[model samples]
Target: MSDLLRLLPWSGPDGRRCYVSADSGGGPVSRLADRLEELQLDTGAELLDHVEELLRAHRVSGDELRFCVHRLAEALRDALRVAESRGRRIPVPEDEMEDEMEGHPEPPGLC
Candidate 1:
């Protein structure tokens, strides 16, 4: 959907990052990748809630903390990837760039 390079939601067979070419983003693979991104984000959110509740308990063991940390790391990686994929698709407004070019980065004292 963007002219910029697009990163897909999955890795390659060798565990390398995967990318897709610019297109209308309506292909079956694209659709599946989008769905996977949604699921990844949902899982990350659920992990966050579980971490909060688990931390609230007073009797956390080293093993429990280790497992939670491992899972949290995974969720964080998914969230970062999703953020990067979505961020690349965001278009910069032409007018905003024009305003910056004119040296009026922000109107008067609205910094």
Candidate 2:
């Protein structure tokens, strides 16, 4: 969705703007969850609960929730990439990285 794209902060990498793919239908959450499940990663109901809390905290609508979910999915992908680059196991937990992956705080007045 364009709204999601607008909300995202863009950065240039190698002189090219990097952006995450959008999920107009909000499908990325389940897709990411499925991937995690396939890898025997934790995709439990508890995490879903946290996601719901985050959406509510941010006043995210169903459609907007899709964007947030997709962001998280991207974060996970990045984490895996970092691990792979270091010749370590995929999905390795890194403290600061985890905080970033958790996403930014809801904008003022959102809650």
Candidate 3:
């Protein structure tokens, strides 16, 4: 395994986060993940537009609201995963990292 560990776009069968080792970002798995990330981001943007329209209606049904919320939750999950994966790849200085760590006593959970 390479020293570079990339958080995968999809989770494991048990719903746990997965990682892949790839020194070069052009590997098949990395390429597939990149495509999936792009799809996720585009889907999130489209979902946001839909949600705005749905919420602006004069009369909104309970079923419609429920469905919207469900899709929003799914989209949020995807967006968060994408953010986390990208965030990890960013280079941060030790002093800045320490400052961030000091502000937050503990790491936040996905929930």
Candidate 4:
């Protein structure tokens, strides 16, 4: 029985904040949140890959390029929010190891 509330990463459909009342951050709801955050990170990685390809191919028009960039920005924001919520640094997914290793420090447990 605790009187503390935990912040969730996402807002409600109506754009309102949400909170969960949990004694510990290891319950079913917390597990679900972890899964969701991982998914969001993965999706952001995918979006980044797609955006890179699109930029290299030079196939998108002015408006389409703008839209793609917007989506990419949103994806980055979502991934960052997930990392913040989990109190961890933004984890570069395995598929991006080559790019990350170029100039960034290795993520935890990778060395």
What does the lDDT read for residue 82 in candidate 4?
68
RMSD of each: 8.9, 19.5, 4.9, 12.0
In candidate 2, position 88 carries an lDDT of 22
Lowest lDDT sum, 10 consecutive residues, model 2, at: 2-11
Decide which is better by lDDT, 2 or 4. Answer: 4
Per-residue lDDT for 8-106 in model 3, tens only?
789887777777664657889889999999999899889989889978875889998899899889889988988988887786787987786676553
lDDT of 4 by residue, 30-88 (tens): 77777887888888889888888888997788997898888888888887776565553
Least accurate 10 contiguous residues by lDDT in model 3:
102-111
Which residue pairs in candidate 4 collide?
Answer: none
TM-score of each: 0.77, 0.29, 0.77, 0.64
User: Local distance difference test, per candidate?
Assistant: 0.76, 0.44, 0.79, 0.68
> Candidate 3: lDDT of 28?
90
Cα lDDT of candidate 4 equals 0.68
Clashing pairs for model 3 are: none
TM-score of 2: 0.29
Give Cα distance to truth, residue 40, candidate 4, Å: 0.5
What is the lDDT for 109 in model 1?
A: 16
Compose the digit string of candidate 2's lDDT tens values, residues 44-85. 344556787886797667876786687568556545543432
Clashing pairs in 2: none
Clash counts for all predictions: 0, 0, 0, 0
